[model samples]
Target: MPFMIGRAPVRRTLKYLESGKIVLKDQIKIFSINYNVGQGFKNKVHEGAQAFVFWTLPQLQYKNPDVQIVTFKNMTPSPFIRCYYEDGKQILIDIDSRSNDEIVNHLIKVIGKSKQVLKAEALAAEEKDNPANFGVGCARKCMCEIPGQIPCPGVCPLPKVMRGKYFYFKKDELENPEL
Candidate 1:
């Protein structure tokens, strides 16, 4: 009942959920990164990989929940990123001696969704969010269209007492009093 301003944790969490709904291309099923923790010069060769993983891992995991991402430290001689596709094909990109930005740019160029695809997806999401749209893809669609589903409050107004606006009236006020 108290009004508040500034950053709300609940709003941030919901925004995170909304922003991370992007699904990776259907072919990409697994993503794996192998690197060594910074140590001696030989191992240090993969410092980029270490930095890249730290920065991008969380975003990748959240953005593409369907894709399994696995990381291995001190497991390989050199740092590399491997993407496994549903067709059993895999792409290996060496990240040794590259900067974090370079690694990210290279990966995006090779494996990220195309700009056109992203635009189409964004458009579809907009359409789905439109209040005037209904049925299968629209979020505002009436649930009653589905078998056995009851109509929602928007489709069939709830009884007065069950509605939020009802509380604004005086206790003794009639629902339909003469003007």
Candidate 2:
């Protein structure tokens, strides 16, 4: 007989953000989805996400198409979903779909992608609207420099990169977070 994992603790954080919210800042805006689901079950999906991080993360550096990366393997413990990535990135994502029927469509997977896409779109839009944001001749020069490890002059000493798995929801979708 196949054993079934009990879904009992899923109710603990009933009033958490599980979808989407965006906040804009002059230096940097954060588009995030917050999920504070079943906070603590360390299980198979969690293990899988870990494995993906270990095996895949090292190989992705300098990879184009997705300089910003996030990978999701599962959702466990009800409220919290499992995402795979390096440590230290601050993030929270929510897709806002009521039913999490399939693992592929889980909050982590969708919202993570949304964060990445929105970031790209924002940069593209900025570049498109303000040509002066670029160099004197529109030559490769831009008002701001790309973020990298070593800080460059006139650049943000620190840059905000999306990190961590967060729940997604529509505006006003989640109630005030239970303190």
lDDT of 2 by residue, 13-111 (tens): 222212223222112122222232222553433443343233323332222223444443343342233233344344443323233333223433443
lDDT scores for all predictions? Answer: 0.75, 0.36
lDDT of 1 by residue, 50-163 (tens): 777765565677778799999998889988988999999999888889988888678777888877888898898776565555676666456566566567877687787876
Against the true structure, candidate 2 reaches a TM-score of: 0.19
Candidate 2 minimal-lDDT segment of 10 residues: 23-32
All predictions: root-mean-square deviation over Cα?
8.8, 25.8
Per-prediction TM-score to the true structure, in the order listed: 0.62, 0.19
User: What C-alpha lDDT, on a 0 to 100 scale, does residue 27 get in candidate 1?
Assistant: 92
- Superposed by TM-score, candidate 2 places the C-alpha of residue 89 at a distance from the truth, in angstroms, of 13
